[model samples]
Target: MENSIILNPEKITADLYPKKFGKAGKIWTVILIAVCAIGLFAYIRQLNKGLVVTNMRDYVSWGIYISNFVFFVAISLVGSLITAIFRLANVEWSTPLTRIAEIIAVSAIVFASIIIIVDMGRPERFMNLFIYGRLQSPIIWDVVVISTYFFISLLLLYLPLMPDLKILNQDPSKNSRFLNHLYRIGGSFWKGTKEQLKINNKAVTTLCIIIIPVAFCIHTVTSWLFATTYRPGWDSTNFGAYFVSGAFLVGAGGVITAMYVFRKAYHLDKYITDLHFEKMGRIVVMLALLYLYFNVNEYLVPAFKMKKPEEEHLKELFTGSFAPMFWFAILVGMIIPIFILIFKRGRRPLPMFIAGVMIMVGAWFKRYLIVTPTLLHPFLPMHDVPESYKHYFPSWEEWAIAAGSLAGALLIMTFFVRIYPIIPIHETINEKNEMAEKK
Candidate 1:
């Protein structure tokens, strides 16, 4: 198997090296930078005015920003899933993808932090979250878990890179000063000594054990931000599991999408192979079905009762203004992907990419559903506000900032792949050697 992978020091060096932008890559970088800049401009305007610039009011206090934050936290869980869960379970095929998952985790979690800060009405008084932070508040719980998750994810991404960084630092001819300096700073002390390996092994094991629960906590606490409220769609016993399962699904979907893009652009076909995508398709299908099952429970139980609050919410979802987005999310995000994945052809890269897009896009709407509809069905009638305030649509500033955050995450991932190996070089080689031994 090692022989079959056709390792070429030069090909690996050329293909995996931090590339100067190709035309498309350059164009993509420009577009993302432009969007982020616009988002920054809009956000500055928002800061100058207030959250008053946007459409949200007291009734819908938590709108698209909260939903988008949840999306980031949920998807960040894929890092733990691929890097920790698969590694602990000794799943060999997942080796190629560990860094992809971990990088996504790190980047997503990083911006999860940023976007939450952006969402704050009082962005300037931000230390209030800490200065007057309440331990009992789910928001505080979120702060705790997100911080812990971030460190664990950072270590998860970094520990695995030592060997590769050491390799990079040794090349005297590589003229990129920043990266060469970064490589030295990252791995100058990493001699890959037996003791260093042992310490690294132990640290990774500790993080692996620790991150699983922290991962659950991050998403669950995120759900709790809703469940703790006495709102219609959010007030349920099932919210935690439903969110966690869906988080795993979307996180898996995100990683799948990122994996395809990275594999294509970096020409890492030999490293991040087709088998990984097939297996990830199976994983996404399982998670999607699980989440859909929970969605039935989440909706049907209250739906069966036709309770006043839930009745209004469910009706809005089924037949009112929100209906199209709701059904589109359910069918496209969950049902169709599950059905398609059952066929082998559908799990191939192209169809899998299509399915990945559906899962991600649908997951966005799903997060919106989790947030807005419930707010709309507030226990108190939404009165004493303007007509437009009664029905929420994002303002242009909101859209720019939201779109910017998404662009920012993608930009981070793109820059990361350019700087570091998107696929783990040491791990992929080790897996190949192990397979050769077996053969």
Candidate 2:
């Protein structure tokens, strides 16, 4: 008996077309807009009052904004994981996931850029980076790679949508006036000719090749921003690999979360099936284990050596004030997820979603642990500063803005789905036909 899954082309098209937002989606959108408004107000206040409105001081220069930036960068790696790596490896099951991952990547990177600007109190001075930017600086490297990655990710997203755009363009009943305009503007020329198809395929493949190294560079440069510093926790050669590994883990977790949400919201059981969750669950576990290995390497050697310079910093993470966050990140982010997904039932959609949330929340706090603790234990003793400088916590403004930025990112993704098909209708149909033929 051939146990192959088959999909009908017309049914697939009907099921996957972009639909107007339902009640739940509309409520979600309104909430996101409100949160973004709050964030905007907070930012205006920040501009008026300066960074003094926040708890960040000399000892803890980078706070929630930087942590948020790092989290965005880490989660954005899912674009490469699903679209580039899986596509290049010829994985068929990921077709439903590529667009999801790409949108997540695009949204995350967009906010990553915004968060960086948020960290810079004087936004106008951002131009100075171009005027006085030095090749020698890691910050410049980060800027270059992030810009390059964003464009490449955008193109990766747009290229795959061209064929689908043609589908939407031809079907007058499927598109609204606004969406029809968008489809025409974006893909009026995509006639699905043999030459056009060949060119598009090559373009996507070439981009897949190019983006892998650029994605690596963006995160590696980010890691360099810390590893190059003289702080005890930050000064290690293992930082790059550790950051990359953790990024992959968080990105995978993000994908799992999206998979469950889209599956439920769109009633996409036939498309994003339980098998998809199972396979993604396995990938998450593998990434969790890999990141766990790096965590051991990152912490164990330093703890074992216990050098005088690192003792206080290591102690803070292991048994001191930051110990709670550190262990939560390790256990909830990596360990518990692994244990959950290791079992057959845990790979189900509901459990996978819960595990994904844990990983993301844990990773966010992990970033805080990465940036704050190291700065707090500076090599030089603190003197002549306000006592508030010794302790660090984000003020109400910081919390509001961070929440708003996050809400805004989700809103962008939500709007994108409302406007465009979350899955690649053309690609999914093609894959279905190919699988049927093979069977």
Candidate 3:
């Protein structure tokens, strides 16, 4: 008899199907929901009392909220990095992680939009962007590109889930009636016929191509929001590339972090193996190195000149009030992770998870460093403003709102896992078939 295949459809289905959340999962979901509730409450308070509730003043008008927005936009780049870029490159090993990246992208972008509105203070004025917005504004560009990227990321996510949805719909007995209904609604027309698969594949390929440029545009436009200004720190020709590189680095870190968590929580070791972590480890190291190179260019050239305006901004980050955070974000975000992931043993799942967490935390503070310090050190000296306006710190409401937005994103990923196969079931089966045939 011919040698048996490594992965049969039945086993794949059973292993990869979405399962009901157990006690720990339930507790986690509840916590995320609670955090979201707190954030919503904070937002309500901000609306009622106005922007004065936050620490934002004339000197530091852009506070942690903008930092959070930048962080979300950075993290959202992972979808294009893993899903579109990897798919177009024919990177087969990445199949298991694509959905994870896409969902992260979708959720991060969703919150990016929400947080920008939060930053606007007067939420009702948002509609003015559509009605009276000028094309000359970088803010308008950001609005356009981010919205476009969200839909493309959503489609990329939903299209791949169609085949898996059809599989779930076939056996309603295994899942709740509500879930069964959702599966049916999502995949009712997906007959999996040859023509349908061909069209689906083509459409996906087209989207994969389209999303790359749009993803770049989204973050590039965002960098322009700062760089276009003649402010000491923001005025740099390198800002666009600097922002894009950091975005990719954080995005990869996020996917790696998610990969480890899902593999452990869902018992997906068969699909998300050690090899996947190893490959992702390599990607993260390269990204970290690339980001470090840009970091050097971003600061070194400015430091060499040390213009009067930039002198204060750079000093504050180098050895002043922001020094600790500045170094922390640099070391933890890029340097230490590079050290950890450079060695072969460090690339293991547990170590990779540690490094991923470090990257994420470091990246968040890095954004804080990027936005807050520069605003405080504008070209013009602070006039006779209140002494409190010279320094900045987030208020309770700002913290709650920021934390809640993060929890909301996590809750989205959590609920998505509960409803759909976190790993692509049908795709994994197809890949296994191809491997077995080659043997």
Alpha carbon lDDT of each predicted model: 0.85, 0.92, 0.93
- How well does each candidate superpose onto the true structure, as a TM-score? 0.97, 0.98, 0.98
For this target, which candidate reaches the highest lDDT against the unseen true structure?
Answer: 3
Would you list the clashing residue pairs of candidate 1?
none
Once superposed on the true structure, which residue ranges of model 1 sit more than 4 Å away at CA? 1-4, 8-15
Candidate 2: the clashing residue pairs are none
Ordered from best to worst lDDT, the candidate numbers read: 3, 2, 1
What tens-digit string does per-residue lDDT give for candidate 3 at 1-439? 1124387999999999999998999999999999999999999999999999999999999999999999999999999999999999999999999999999999999999999999987899999998999999999999999999999999999998889988998988998989988988899889999998998899889999999999999999999999998898899999989999999999999999999999989888888888898999999999999999999999989999999889999999999999999999999999999999999999999999999999999999999998999998888777799999989999999999999999999999999999999899999999989988888
What value of lDDT does candidate 1 attain over all alpha carbons?
0.85
- Candidate 3: give the clashing pairs: none
How many residue pairs collide in each prediction?
0, 0, 0
- Score residue 386 of candidate 2 by CA lDDT: 88
**For model 2, how does the per-residue alpha-carbon lDDT over 221-240 read when each residue is reduced to its tens digit?**
99999999889899999999
Misplaced by over 4 Å in model 3 are 1-5
Which residues of candidate 2, in runs, are more than 4 Å off? 1-5
